[model samples]
Target chain A: MNINHVDLAGYLTKSLDADEHRQAEEHLATCAECRAEAESLQEWTMALEAVPEAMLLDGPPDDADLLLQRTLRQIRQESSGANRRRSTLVGIAAAVVVAAAVAGGAAVGRFTSPSDAPPVAQPPTAAVSSGPTAAPGTRTATAVDATTGARITVALTPAPGWIRVKAAVAGIPQGERCLLQVVDKSGKVTLAGSWLVSEAGADDGTTLDGSALVPLDQVGSVRVVTEGGKQYTSVSL
Target chain B: MPGFRLQRRREVADEALVRSLFAEHGRAMLAYATQLTRDRAAAEDVVQEALVRAWRHPESLVNGKGSVRGWLLTVIRNIVTDQIRARNARAPEVRESPVDVPSDEDHAEQVVNAMVVVDALSQLSTEHREVLEQLYLQGCTVTEAAKALGIPPGTVKSRSFYALRALREIKSLSPAGTERSAS
Candidate 1:
């Protein structure tokens, strides 16, 4: 049966019963404008649906036993792993903690020092290696602005429990800004910080220097973000 | 494969199937429960209680084509609805903004399309916006939303009708088409 046309909005809202909806669907098949409108609505719906599913979890409260079970499972796993590698994990954790404290203190010193002195703190000159070597630590990074040729270096000392982050630019513009973030062993972000450096009375972008001492435990990875809106991220654990 | 088969077999009289069902659908059900309750912590508790309840009555689900997951979603929904009703005197607050598509990675064309819809929706009255949001974003049926709002289901249906029509017309017409419809 041929049915009279309803406006496109009624169809999208799904207010019509089965028969009316079927009629609208039939009309849409032949009507170009309605068909285009329907397609656009569908496209909009699809795009909205692509929003992170995490958004739906916004208001709903988690059920109690489910939360308990999940929590218990996570705890059991962590405990078992901890038991298996208690000694080594403890040593590493302590080292990182110590590194953080010393590095934090050294950072205060480096930043607070008289601006006239040639920033005595050296950029970290550490090397990257596998499995928490007997030798302390290393820093590595690449500059995002390659034409600007910027680089950030990180250095670590396990016993002293400090990590140093330093940046240098060669053949690029001066007064560039840099920011840092550290990702820890368990994949948690431990720190996010930034600073800018400029050579003394030099207009050339060739040389920039700034440094921070981050504790080794908090030094899983260091990221450098430049003022020209470039990000250089790296990880070590 | 063995676990799937065992969960499928209602005739086996096996105790382990209960645990298997719980493991498979537990997290998803918890997510649904949270949406229904709009409280993450409470939803988790509801899911856990529902699963434990199901575990005690595994035979209730025998000869069912629907996996244990569907049953959990239903149970969680009912429980949350009941809770909301029991606290009916209180206003519903703590609404999370509706989830929208990520702004990142959208091409210029998609962005323009989205802006069209967004601009039209923005022109809607708060009443229209709230009803549409509840229905589309929160996935609430008109009846459910009416009960929550202490309004008639017909009101929700009509409001949704006008709101969507206005949105469609706005999309079709030029920016000059700001005239409100009589519908």
Candidate 2:
């Protein structure tokens, strides 16, 4: 019997009719192709069933409080129905700043001789225009990487009872996992978030947004660290 | 006065429901999202969006036929799909590599499977992953998977053949052979 692929799949899934099942079984007892296919399908099925249990051994990231705070902030924003307009305005402002920085930096580099060009372009902090605060206050900070010419701009917003930290980082290497850590005046360090640089973003940069449960007043500094625990840059608040 | 009291009671109930949902399934949902997005920050965004959506339609929690976790996982899958679509649209020049686009059913299956399998799936070509997802996970017939994936049924069979062969060689599964006894 020349068993078709569909017939084999049907037999494996038990979707075959009785006669088809019996015929396939008889052929499977002799044919090498049918037997190998059947065994492979069985192994695949067993592996599929093991997936959920396997995932349970390695659970979510360790920072549950940060996740809860971020979710609550999203819930509050959506329920209030004001998130869209605010997000749009923020998006526009960010675009303009990025465009200006790229264009201005290029212009300065073109006219200045190598010796005359200022080192590292002035820190990005000077370029950030602080946005107006609503119920939860907002603060802005920026850091520059002297060696890599990368810049990181961060926005801190108070959400409910926690501090929401959003950072836009540029010029980080692709495929490297970077972490954002927030340190309080009391010396407690909270892992705010971690992200990988997208293929495109690695060429330019990417913005990472995350929230932490620390109070705004308590935060003294924020640091971006690579997966290797090396601090890439730090910004004082 | 009675209306005010009733509203307060409903609010309390909603709060309890939301807390319970998070306590029971938050870690799993986060883990699943992290695997799908491959970025913890984006995973948080996916989890946040899904939870907020669940909160808005609190009735979903009570009325869902499957477990609340399943519903939440479905919601996360949809959001991630939309995010990937939007990103693709914005940067048409920089298309995701073939290996990056896991089939629809594979995304759903990954929610249940361990991150190790998810990592293994990432290693396979996108075509191979899609075939297994449709046949094994979605339980689609070969013909059905072919139609869904816009390939011929023969291609589906051939792909599945190679996919299973590759899965057998995946290094992550080697350790599991011994660990399965411990598990």
Candidate 3:
């Protein structure tokens, strides 16, 4: 007996009941045509499964982090403002701009200063003297944008409900409004703070301070993104 | 003040749930979306939308019997499908060529299966994952994988067989075809 598309779908999805599933399996073992079709489906399934790991190996574009952050923020807004349905629609409009930033592949190079031709080697330091109690050890990570050569160094000091983030960033486009965001282990992101890049500071690099509403341990990474939601640089912490 | 405290507690709980969901499955979901859309930006958009949808219907995610990763991937699939349909509608000229062999439904189903398989892969043991990763992901022969993983050739073959079997046994392998059907 020939297996139809519906049966193939059922078999592939495991929607078939036990008896039918067993029969389909038995039939597939013998029928050449059905076996070929099943093999094709299985091959596609394997290809699909391999894609994610492959992409990870390939290194996802920088803006990918920014996109996720903006999306989470939008979702939070929608959930909290359930009554303001119209505003949610407006948020969708704004998401398009964010999407465009990612698609355009904005360059995030390090600003070259007359004093320093090579990449700066300063370790990120946390200004925790005045903040709430700090965690025992400071954690830091730095990432450079391959395209723009922009660099961002994130220094995280653990706190109870919030972690103080001190970032030193260079190579951001002068005068672009940018935000510092912290993504927790669960992929939850909080706005650390926002700042405008100064023309002189862009060349010399600038330091910004902010705090995320998550403890130090919960923090996964820190990212610098343009006001339009294009990620300049990110470093896993 | 007590009422405010209760609301804050609920908010914290919800936030925690969201964070946990992302931590466990965010990478897989992003990869699945990236595959479907072929553009990191568009993929991010799909993931973002699906996540927002998840937030709106947190109960489906937190309480539903299906795997959260599977559910999230399914949502991403549907969103991609909608975007494709919208694009085709807006520019019928592009669809006139019919460059792709698989119909939208077939592609969508394949995507669902792919996500399920990826999620299953994540559940495998480190050894199982390593064997499969070397063989399938890195295109290594059994001997090559064994060499790379510091295992014997025979063990590599055996591990590969069992890993495949384990992948086949993942119970929630069905594609969540639609939003209504997924829940």
Per-prediction TM-score, please? 0.26, 0.35, 0.45
- Worst 10-residue lDDT window for candidate 3 chain B reads B5-14
Question: Which 10 residues in a row give candidate 1 chain B its minimum summed lDDT?
Answer: B6-15
Better of 2 and 3 by DockQ: 3
Residue-wise C-alpha lDDT for candidate 1, range A57-81, written one tens digit per residue: 1112223344645644543354344
Candidate 1 chain A minimal-lDDT segment of 10 residues: A90-99
Per-residue lDDT tens digits for candidate 3, residues B2-64, read 433333323333343344344334555677787787677777778778877765664454244
The global Cα lDDT (0 to 1) of model 3 is 0.54
Question: What are the chain A TM-scores for all the models, listed individually?
Answer: 0.28, 0.43, 0.43
Tens digit per residue, CA lDDT, model 2, A151-206:
56666766566788887666565677899889887778899999886765654456
Q: Candidate 2 residues B10-72, lDDT tens each?
A: 233233334434543566567678777767888888887887777666445334443344466
Please give me the DockQ of candidate 1 compared with the native complex.
0.03
Write down the TM-score of model 3's second chain. 0.68
Per-residue accuracy of model 1 over B1-183 as CA lDDT, tens digit each: 533322222111111222333433444455455445445678666766665555334433332333233344545655654554444323235332322112211222232232234334434555664565555544567676576545787887767656665666656533253222232
True contacts kept of 1: 0.03
Error of 1 at B173 (Å): 15
Q: What is the number of residue pairs that collide in model 1?
A: 32
